[model samples]
Target chain A: MYSVEELVWNDSFINWVRYNKNSDFWESLRASDPAVEENIRKAALIVKAAAATPEIPVEESEAAEVWNRIRRDTAEPETGNRKWHWAVASVAAAFLVFLGIYNYGKTDTRVSYENLISEVASSDYKEIRNDGPDPVSVSLPDRSSVVLYQGSKIGYSLSGYNREKREVYFSGEGFFEVSKNPQKPFFVYSNELITKVLGTSFTIKAPENSEKIEVIVKSGKVEVITRKDPRKKKVLESKELEEGNYLVENQKIDLERATMKLSPIVKRELTELNHAVQQMKFDFDEEPVTRIIADLELAYNVRISYDKVKWQGTKLTAHLSDEPLYDKIEMICKAIEAEYEVRPDKIVIK
Target chain B: MTRLWRSFIAGDEDAFSEIYEAFFKILYRYGYHFAADHSLVKDAIQELFTDLWRLRSNLSDTTSVKFYLFRSLRRRLHTLAGGEDVYQALPLSENDLRGLQTDSREQYLIDKETEEIHLKQLGEGINKLTTRQREALRLKYYEGFTLSEAASIMNMNEQSVRNLIQRAIISLRSLLS
Candidate 1:
């Protein structure tokens, strides 16, 4: 049977659109056996149900720390990851000809980050190999679990997982579901990249003789860094693999071992634009115009300044769905017969 | 949410902040499932959104905000745990519940049996469940009373008894989630 993940992600399958060129492909296949449609429908519902799992409520206490972190991050825009990625990329691009040993260390933290990862990767660990046919599941001292694939080997602390750090040296493939301990950060050394996590689940596939290493996120965030640099003097220790990326669920990062380049594609990044809030139909039945505009501003995350007191009594019934923000504004303006001006950060209605 | 996300992607500072505010708790609920360590879950959640905001410009458009946050939080937690997805289901069956299923009591149904565990942890978890749910569960599951019997004993309606049982299930699931 076709895989569920692939089929759900396949828009053509979900939408059931068989165009002329590929028509013959599915046509001939289904022509031989017409009963295949049942499997397709069941797969669609299961995939849909996966997305429609009961809404889990996130507690207010749980959100407090995350709120602080995001605010602090976005608040300081200049020093963010994108800026670092760009600066390193541009430097790499500009001085590719002079790409020997250089001291581009002071300005960017990439240098220190690279060294930190290298230092972690080269640490001491006891090795366990899965030569047998069955997958070997290892329980760490701290209770984190590792399922080693056949022919793969992993190394961890020989003295049992030390309190300060939990490290794993892996080659081939493994699935990890690490127990949580905030003090000791978890590190997986796979190929040139080191996957670091505090407490989460993820998988790393580093097959022997393959040009690419794939790290797929099962859950939680992890920082991926390249152990890409060779030994240089104090001038520079190491360089980052194009700044780190945090891959979320249903996302995969493919790193070309040849170039030490990493690229991530998160499912959220490629969604079919499914917004639950936007799906709510808006039919203002003689409601205050301010209410309408307010809801719109809230939904669009835009600011709309208008004389609310004057328009408090104004009421109108209008239905709107799936229209562009500007178009929605235009319709509201036409109904209210109010003039509007588009400002840089907001809209002004008079 | 689409519009907010569009604005966030467009590098609107306010929209990004708003998104953070809107989805932080929801992400937390999804995250706690991976690890029982509350603080660790919180830190992972903080790091997830912080990274998301940092990579806001790079994020692709998404339709399902809940799934997006959920999936992101799961990935974040796993990365922190330094493992693959921890949300794997164990081969739990009614037999595995230590004969809780055959008791024909509603308490077994309420607890949604798992392997035997520590008493203190179970107490802490049971404490979080509501009194109504507990009463309903005990009367219906422990005492082997029918839904209506439990309701009449508790002086409540059958619908309320059903609702109580549902709330109990939800409460128990939240502990795991």
Candidate 2:
């Protein structure tokens, strides 16, 4: 129940009217909420009239020229930046004939790198959707593999990963095994959450029609942030991801569907290792408690506070690979009869 | 918006073309409003797209595509203008004037508003608005940007944008009447 002005001035509704998008839903709304019909009609007319055309917005020849110029500039192998670089290089060569440090102010790749990330992202997307009961498998630009559950779809740009970060749009559940690239992070935008990782594997289940989005990290760490502002409420919004709540591996984050509140990251009780980390095994042969603590610390990137001298000769034989790192620690504590406390960043064993 | 930008950066030719075509007119008109120079506007837009393509691979994410393009166009126009005074040029040429009128809809709207008096009143009402108000109206209504996006383009806060748009709409409606 929006006022006439609000309805007409609404960006998405205007787009809907112009494009006839989501027609059925709007029609049903109008049918149910009859009072807004007159307003809807008036707003539609106003938008239509305002968007009216007398001539092409841009002349064809002019558009052609712009396109032509774009083609020329983008297609050119030896462009202005290169020439400038060469000119600077020659000037340096002539000025400092003697061998000297010449690389200080010679950053020439920056312009091209900037150009690469911005324009290279454009293109038709390769969409992988799973409609049948079976899950669908797809590979990403960074050699990451995704298994989309039934009723799920993922669309990603065709460009292979290079310097740019990898991203994907997922609706419904998707299991991803992303390749490692510390420099370039990979991102997943689900219902109300943006999951970011340098390189890791995880499973995100966000049903298309549902508000709830669950992100569970299997291996490596990921930052899942909820992007919802309580002030700005809209029925449907097609928006880029926002940042806020963060979650890591051996953790699960659930975005409240109704409220769009990002719950805190809870420890992963059932840690499912993805393909990348599946090969890593925590097999040990009567390894000392101190040594085992060190290995576990390295494996999960957590600090373990323990008396190396007291547990120097205490040996334990166990393959606690299947369980999560926390669970493994719990089992080890139980076996060795050691009291332990879990701090935010470290495990203290006494 | 980030996805589109990323694709363009990743050397997706199609994305580049779509972004160019989709934004060209809006950027063109936006630049036109400031300088009233068609060629200048065109060059500014072309340069903007060119620079964007060049730097696509490294551009950060944006929340709104419309806002991002307008912001870029403004920056490009500023650089292209090089401190040259604008708006004194005033009034577009006959050929350039028609550039803003969309095809098919132009005839329809003119026919709908066949009365010269109504057209005059509409024009006068639009002229009555301050430059900022007019720009805000255009960005909000014609360009179909949300208040936030318009605010970003205008370099104003959201509350200011909302007030400007609301005031503009009210004044225009009153003046037209």
Candidate 3:
């Protein structure tokens, strides 16, 4: 049997050979080797058998018609449980058809809302309930993510998706991994407070009275502004919070200079920096040998062989890539009052 | 929809509806593949399309409707499949699901052979690769995207994409030969 390599490498020639059993590409070669041509023809037979199975059809009408029926029944304004299945089916049909065609030409670019809107539509907003004690997750249309906390109700508008903004209404707590969109700012409405972000990973807390609305920045910076604040009707008291920062109400603002008073936004940049340092084996400006040895061992999976008397009190300072461990080890050895040699997988200090 | 795409971008409802009708199936099918649930899939596809329609004015600048549909399908599928934690859904045992003989290796072979005979062999050679390989090919070929684009979507390094494409073409050439 021909290998995957042979078949894939000359796929065009093979295909050409398969379709035109006696094409020139093969003619020149086949004249010298009839067996290879025969093999190529036989491969074509196998390929034909596969294609005969049926190409997944791209239908515009069935999906469209399903949605049409859904729109018709749903528009009646008196839909019951009976209509729900059919409505859901129509939406499913539209979804499947759209998927088959869309994946047919897998795109590399992120799909824009405008482009997404043009491709398809369905009318079904079925609730997904997870009874597990753990958090239940629900993904939105724009590729952002939502982890619904226990006992929460969030609804989406599929049919009326092509609006000015992409909004999801949530009645409880949820963490969001929002897909980035410079134009369409994602809004999560909870407890009379609407949190808007471009693209970020954050947990939204909308507890009761002392239940403050908190936006914890996980990765990207989020501009959490009051969507409906009486104080700034046009634009709420907005603050740009970075990673490891908290934006909340009633928090005291640091009055900087007369022109710039820090808002209620507070960032614990130091905390994050400290945590990052904890992961480091050695981050030292003073005695560097111990730290260097610890980091080098972790990097190269090797043990150090050095005299405690010679290297005990030695220290050095350097930034390691944590990659290409040997290079770092060499740099460290040169910096110190010692030298080193690589023995198989292990490094020995001399 | 009664109006054309241009009209929809102009904020015409009729044109928006027409665009919706034309592309609804593509979105729904892709969603079903990803979500594997009828109701969840439907709601996602519908919501995405409706959202798109509402923002039809922005559609004026886009070139291909298909690219938009696929991209949306991927996003929605990621949502249904567990968002950031997509690997949560493990591949079902053959007995658990349809038990159809859809083994990756077998599919790879048949798919490659079929492409060799029917589709452009060079293209098929590129197509009949691992899902990752095929995607890398599509980004490089069909969309003319930079290696960076392929890497971002595949969530791999740009250097990795370059290496993958290079290897894919080598394999393709050998198959053709």
What is the alpha-carbon lDDT for the whole of candidate 2? 0.57
- Superposition TM-score, candidate 1 onto the true structure: 0.27
lDDT (tens digit, per residue) of candidate 1 on B1-177: 897788778876656666766766655544554575678877887777777777877787874555466556666776787865454221223232333221233233223333233222233444455556654654443334456665664556899988876665444434432
Ranking by lDDT: 2, 1, 3
All models: lDDT?
0.52, 0.57, 0.45
Off by over 4 Å in 1: A1-124, A229-244, A268-350, B1-177
Per-residue lDDT of model 1, residues A1-350, tens digit only: 54433443354553332122354554454345434543343333322222222234465554554564555555652334322211211100000000112222232213222233344434554677877544545556666655566667677656545556777777766556565555677777665666767665554555554556655553466556566533212112122212344565545565665556666554422221122122233456887897788666544445676765578889988875433455567789999999888654357788
Which whole-number lDDT from 0 to 100 does residue B40 have in model 3?
69
Every candidate's DockQ is: 0.12, 0.11, 0.04
Superposed by TM-score, candidate 2 places the C-alpha of residue A209 at a distance from the truth, in angstroms, of 74
Go through the candidates in order and give the clash count of each.
Answer: 35, 34, 51
TM-score of chain A of each: 0.38, 0.39, 0.33
lDDT of 2 at A89: 11
**Per-residue alpha-carbon lDDT of candidate 3 for residues A40-84, written as tens digits (9 for 90 to 100):** 544443333222211124454456545544443333233353322
Task: Kindly report which residue stretches of model 2 are placed more than 4 angstroms away from their true locations once superposed.
Answer: A20-57, A70-350, B1-4, B61-64, B82-124, B175-177
Model 3 Cα lDDT, one tens digit per residue, B1-177? 222555656764434455665666645543453445656666666666666665656664444555565566567667667764231122222232222222453343345444434334433443355655555654554343456765665567999987876676566555544
Interface RMSD of the candidates, in order:
13.5, 11.0, 17.4
Better of 1 and 2 by DockQ: 1
By TM-score, the candidates rank as 2, 3, 1
